[model samples]
Structure formats: structure tokens, C-alpha cells
Target: MTASRTTSAPSVDRLAPWGFAAFVEANTHDTAYRPPVVDGPVGPTIVRGGRELVNFASISFLDLERHLPVRRYFAEGALAHGLSTSGSRMTQGICRPHHVLEQTIARHTGKERAISFATGLLANIGFVHAMSSAAHFDAGIEVRNRDTVFVVDRDVHWSIWKGLEGLGYGRNVHAFRHNDVTDLARILGRDRSRKTVVIAESLYSADGTMGPIVEILDACDRHGAISMIDDANGFMVYGPENRPYAREAAAIRERADFVMVSLSKAVGLEGGAIAGPAAAVDAFELLSGTSMFTAAIQPPTAYAAERTIDVLAGTPEIVDDYLAHAARLRRQMHEAGTPTLPTESYMLSVPIGNDAVALQMREWFVEDGYLVPVFSYPAVARNQALLRLFPHAGHTEEQLDGFLRTLATYRQRLGL
Candidate 1:
């Protein structure tokens, strides 16, 4: 998801979850079975087209969405309050659900304030815009927007890059190699005079790799640079006192200037947020065009997200067991000679490195009754597409073992 450009269109033979006759035919020549409409709840096994398949494409690693309490809260909230906020938060003003959700987020992340947005993508764009504009009072702590430099990780989400579009800071923007502290240090040390902002994610979504959080912070500190962590996948999953991973989780919130999390990921709901000082959060809400113009998240989902955070904190064992399964799968993949991408998180990606073979491998998984996702072309480097597998906590041992067998068979058949 690095803030890179993708000029080519996505490969759409069966990439989507539902059928699109025109799209499938127009994109590729494959006549394989189209994506079928799923039925009922999303879990270890998905029902579609009168057949059950082992599921491997859901991001709800803890399966909190399927929990009885989560469902009850969501259903009750929706019943009590109808969907839709009716207007943007600025125009219609804030609701109780949104306010409580923001408070929970701010408390969990140790930030003085937090502001929610409709999506993580919107959050990134809005943060970048609000921080990089001279119209705002702080404007890089009195430094001009044109003078402030943006030093980003080579591979950040595209939304961050989109926020920088037409800012007229052509050479001012610098990119260091992904997770390379030396490169980051070199870029930061070169120009000590400029006010720099280093942007990077806590956990990359595409290949499941993690950024060097502590090291990144140290670099920003020495260079007098502001740090922003896109913790879309790491917020409730890593950086907290009760989170499953990252021993220094609590330190992240205290160190980073800005921490953004996705309600859609660990919270098991929709929307995104930025947690930081009260002043910056207030300014962002008022000045961000992306935030001021867009509608807020619905009431029920916000309430569910607020409760889900507590539910997740209370149940760390679920995440612990799931990560154990993911580690086993990663080891098994290595023993079978199918190496996954560099990722400590549950995100497991097996590189196929060729678009045609990736599509063929997906077909094989489908035949074996598993709906595996393949990323190619624009989403990833051309010819560097891979298989993205999501191992859920609810999946049984038998299901995971069978999927491993499928992988071994594919590796041998492909002769890679």
C-alpha cells in the first residue's frame, strides 16, 4: 500500500467477491467460475452457490464480529437508532455515538483528543491536507507550508500520496527505502533546517510487513521531525497495554505526534480516526475539506465500535491463539518451500511473482473449495502479485491443514 502510483488497471477475472459479467469479460479471457454471492455470516467456512468453502479472505483476525455480544450490541443499536447520520458532522453536529467512540479511542491510545472520519483513506488524506496547508494557524508550528518537508516511507498507503497531490512541493518530498532506518536517517540528516514530517504505517496491509516503529521515532526525534503512524492495522491489534503483540505498545502513543486507527479493522466496524493533541484534532476537524464535506459514520456502527474496543481488550487470548495459528502456518509454508512475505502480523502473503500463475493458483484454490485472494497489477508491482491469505481464529485445525496441503500441491505443480 506504499504511497506509490499504479498506472495499470486491476486484474478483475475473479478478484471481486461478486459476479460482474461485463467486468469479467472486459478485463480478462478466463472462463473460470465467477465469484459467487456469499450467504449468512462470514467465518471459517463460507456458504456460496450451494457449496461450503474454507474462507481465507476476511481481515477480522479475532473474529469479534461473529461474537454473540458484538452482534447483540450492533443489532440492538441499529434497532434503537435508524441508519444514516443524515448530514456531515460539521453541518448536522456530532451525535452521542460518535462522541463516545471518539472518547474510547482517545483513552485507549493515550491521546488528549481523537477525531473520527468515514474511512481510513479519508483520514490520511485529511491529516496530510490539514497539516500541510498554510491557511491553518500552526502550519508546521509557524513554518510555511512550502518550507515544511514531507519525508515518507517508500511504501505507505496511496491515500497519503493523494493528499500531497498539487501541493507544489515537487523535490521537497523525500522517500526512504521501506523499513530502512539508515535511508531514513540519511534523508532526515541532509537538511536539518527544514521542518520535516515522517509518515509511515505501523503495519502494512498488503504483504503484512511491519515498519520499524521505535527506530522511526528515534530518527524523527534527532531531526526535529514530526511523526505520524498509520496504525490502521496496529491500533487495537498492537499498540496498547492489553494488545496481543508489541511489548512496547504503550510507548507508541506517547512518542508519536499523530496516531491513526481504523474502526473497520480491530474495532470490527466502519470508519477511521486520528488520535493526538486536542488542538491538532480540533483544527483537523474544522479545516480538512475531506472531513468537513463527507458524511459521518452511522450511529449503530459507531456504538458497536465503541463496545468492540472493550470486548477486544477483555479477550487477548483470542488474538494470542490466532497469532499462534498464523505462526504455525508460516512455518509450515516455509517447510513446504512456499515462503511468505516479511510479516510478523497475521497477514500472510505468498508471492507467485507472475500474474498468469497467480490467477491459475487462485483457480486451483477455488477448485479445492477455498476463496483465496490474488493481488496483481495496480495493487502490487506488475508481475509481482501474490496470494493474500487471512487465517481466522474460528478456523478449525482440519480446515487449516487442508489449506496447507493445497499450497504444497500448488508449489510442486508450478515448479517454482
Candidate 2:
């Protein structure tokens, strides 16, 4: 060639630090492949890459996303409210849709007031930060004095930990054993002089377990501590007569000082709300960093959430139907000798104990026209990986049977 061109290879060091690059490279070759893309609404069955698969990975418990009425409402809201809120609620984003959704959520949850956030994770973080450091942000007073303590359950979601750390109160946070009321009481007894706020979840998503919220709140009352329940997984799914609170809705509303709920799960929308007394809700609206800094939830999502609340209120049987389906599936799994954790809600988790096998089983499930996700290390303990299943109101008996049959065939390979 008369003319030759020389090009130097890109330097890896200039791209990323060695350790970071190595870590990413290792994960790329890891046994577990990341989730695939989906083309449409996530329901009992999902379309992935033009193939339909039995989907157990979705958290849309009621499948309202596919309901004709719900979809119509969503489309109407989109046309009416444009696309985005475009600003924070404190500034220019406050709209009619937001007010309606907030009022609906407050009424549905039986709280004095409710304030919406962009997501459940944001709601939890914002609520904890605002409540724990209210005085500081409001009147230049440090409410989290040396005597204040945050007694949190060990199994509480990571969002709770991030909240504490964000407020620089990580050192003041103490963790009690998971779902152990006795341990919580013991910890509370040791520091009765401090202003303590106890944090726990109503339903833990990972292990498929319900917290002893009644007992935990009672202990908080006896020890002069405030209690907060993150009911993201339990809201609208478990209640009186299998409605919302497992027959203890009234007690929970009365005893828990604060409750956080997610609209993305059973409510079948995309937002979250912190529900409690009017004073706390108002304070969070004013001082919560996330609320003040981030743009409010889109108007379409807010409107959809309001419509979802209306549907749930008008159709009580829907909740009962979901519970029935979940119970039937659990019974079938048990009868088939498949191990499942005892849970009060619709989540069913089967501990697989090995990360590689859990990853392998997920591949088998997908290949067999099913989509069930696996939770491995870093999400859980080192050896406590689990196959998480969510039974929805839209699932049919035939679908459940087919899923169970597939599991039976692969049970030995998964070491279940």
C-alpha cells in the first residue's frame, strides 16, 4: 500500500480503574445472565423477544395494567396531563391529579394525610430523613441529639439503611434480629431514655415473611418509641377478611405512628406515599429532601394511581380472588414436595441455597416458557439464594399447573 494508517488500541486504564473494570468483566462472564427485555405489559404471561412466557417475576399482583378500564384511564390521563409534571411539587409541579391521588391514598389507607413520592425507595428514604431530623431542617434545632436512637429490624430494606446514612445517623442506628420481637424488646429496654424510632416492614419481599407488626408496635409503645411500618409489599394485598391488613388493619392504623406504601405493586401504578398523622405528613411535604429537590411523580402516574384506588374500593372481591389464587398455589407447591416459606401474603420464596444452581434453574425456567427470577448473594446471604414467585389475580389454574410440572421436572437438577 502506498499509504498506511496506524491506530493505537484504546487504553483500559483511561477507561476505568483496574479494579472496577475487572469486576465488570468478571460479572459479564458470571453464570447468571441479566434479565431480558419485555415488549408489553407485565402480567401472568409476558412477551419477551416475540415469545410468550409464563411470567412470575412481575410485582403487578392484580394485573390491573392489562385491565381494559385501567388502561383506558391511563390513556385518558396521559392525554389530559401531557407527559411530565416538569417540576417539584413545592414549586411548579403541584397539579390536580396529584391532589386527587394523595386524597385517595390517604382515604384508602385510613391515614390522616398522605404525601406521594416518585417511587417507594424515595418515599422510604425521604420519610426517614425528614422524620428523624425534622427539628434540624425546620427550626435549626438538632432533634437527633446524642440521646436519639434508631432501632431498626435487621431485615429491613436497604432503603432504610440509606436513609439513616444520608442523615449521618448511621452510627446511632441499631439493628435487632429479623422479626424477633423479643430481641427488639431487649434492645429497646437497654436505652429507654433515648428517643427511639423503630423501623420494620409489614411483609419482607425477599424471604416471603410477615413481621409481627402488632407485637413490634406494642413494644415500641411500652418503651416510649415511635414505630414505622414499610408496607410496600403488604398494602392492598393483605387485610381484614383478606383485604389489606390481614384483619388487623384497624390496629395497625391506630398503633403505627407512620406507614409507607408503594403504588407500583398491588395498586398497579408507579408512585409511593407516606401515610400518618397530618402533622408528620405536612412536615415531610415541607422538609423532606427528596420531595423538595426531585420532580413530583408524573401527572399520568398520579391519575392512574387515583383510578386504581377507585377500582380496588369498588371491587373488594378482586383482593379476595388474588389471595385465593396465592393460597392455592402455595398448597399445590407444598403437596408436590416443593419447599416454600410460610407467608401471609402472595409472595412465595423457595430457598435454593446455591448461587450457581439458582442461576442455572432460572435459565431452565425461561427455556421452558416460564420467567421466574432468582435472588442470589449480595441480595441475600452468601448461600441463601431463592427462587421468588409472585402469584397474581390474573394467573389461571392451568398456568399454575404447568409451572409446577416444569418445576417438578427440574427439581432434582436444582437440588430442591
Candidate number with greatest lDDT: 2
Please tell me which predicted candidate would have the highest TM-score against the true structure: 2
Note the Cα lDDT for every prediction shown: 0.80, 0.81
Tens digit of per-residue lDDT, candidate 1, span 80-182? 7668788878777887888998999998888999999988889999888878776635645442465667888878999988987776543668888888999
Clashing residue pairs, backbone N/CA/C < 3 A, model 2: 238-244, 238-245, 239-244, 239-245, 239-246, 239-247, 240-247
Off by over 4 Å in 2: 1-12, 28-34, 65-68, 134-147, 166-170, 242-245
Summarize candidate 2's per-residue lDDT along 358-407 as a digit string, tens digits: 88888788889998878888888888889999887788889989999999
lDDT of 2 at 191: 74
Candidate 1: deviation at residue 200, Å? 0.4
- Candidate 1 regions exceeding 4 Å error are 1-26, 29-36, 47-51, 65-68, 136-147, 192-194, 240-248
